[model samples]
Target: MTASTKPYLLRALYEWCLDNNQTPHIVVWVNEHTRVPAQYVRDNEIVLNIGQTASHNLSIDDEWVHFSARFSGVAHDIWIPVGHVISIFGRESGEGMGFEVEPYQPENTDTQADKPQAAADKPAEAAKPKKGLKLVK
Candidate 1:
C-alpha cells in the first residue's frame, strides 16, 4: 500500500502556521489508542494547541504524535496516532485541512478473540458530522 500523505501535510501546515504567527491546533479523535487527558475531551474528540509555546518535545511522525504539555497546571504526556487526527488548523484564522478519521486497529491482534466483542459484532455506521470536522464561514 502507498504511504499516507497526512503526516506530511500536517507538518507543512504546522510550519505555515508558525511562519504566519498563528497558533496551530489539531483536532483529534479520541479512542483507546489515544493518550490524552480525558477530562478535556468532548464528544470523543479534543482540540490540542500544538504551537511551540504550548508543547515541548513535540514530534509528529508517520505513526504518532508525541508531546508534553501542561493541563490545569499539571504536566502530561500526550500520544496520538496520526490516523486519529481529524484536522489541523490555525487557532486564529481557522484555516487548514481536515482528513477522514480512521478507526484504530492493533496490528498484533491475531484472532477475533483478541478483538473487542462490541467492535467486532457491531456493523459499520456512517460517519457522523459531530465526529468529524466541519468548515465554518
Candidate 2:
C-alpha cells in the first residue's frame, strides 16, 4: 500500500508527480513470457490523470485510505496509489495472489518516447529506442 512502509517504488514515482502537481500515468507490466487480453490488462495498470476528484472515505486498509486514481471499468472505484500497489498479477510466483504486489518502475525509453512519429509500442527496430510520455503540466 502506498500508505504503508513497504517499498512501493511506483507509488514513490506517483508521489513525486503529485508533489510536483503532475498527473501520473502508468503502464502496468507483465512477465515477458505472459500473454493476456488488452481489456483484462488495461485497468491493471492505469493512466490516471488525477483531475480534482475529492478524496473519498471508501474503506480499504487504514493506511491506504487516501485520494487515489479512479478510472473506467474495473470493479474498484479508486486506486491506493503506486505505493499501495504491490503485485497485480503475481509476476513473482506466477501463481501468487492475483492482487498481490511486488514493486513498480516506469519504463524509461524517455528519448524515443518523445518522438511523434514513432508507434506506441515502438517495436524494437535495431537499437533505436522506444519513447516515454512525460506530462508537461
Per-candidate alpha-carbon RMSD to the true structure: 10.9, 17.4
- Provide the lDDT at 67 for model 2: 38
The alpha-carbon root-mean-square deviation between model 2 and the true structure, to one decimal in Å, is 17.4
TM-score of 2: 0.27
Write model 1 residue lDDT over 4-104, tens digit each, in one string.
89989999999999999999999999986677888999999999999999999888877778888999999877877788999999999999999999776
lDDT against the true structure, each candidate: 0.79, 0.35
lDDT score of residue 27 within candidate 2:
35
Instruction: Write down the worst ten-residue block by lDDT for model 1.
Output: 121-130
- On TM-score, the candidate that comes out on top is 1
Query: Least accurate stretch of 10 residues (summed lDDT) in model 2?
Result: 89-98
The lDDT, on a scale of 0 to 1, for candidate 1 is 0.79
lDDT of model 1 at position 107: 56
lDDT for each residue of candidate 2 in 15-123, tens digit (9 for 90 to 100):
5555655544433343321122235455455322332343233222322323333335333334232333433222222321223454423345355564332222323
Give the clash count for each candidate: 0, 14
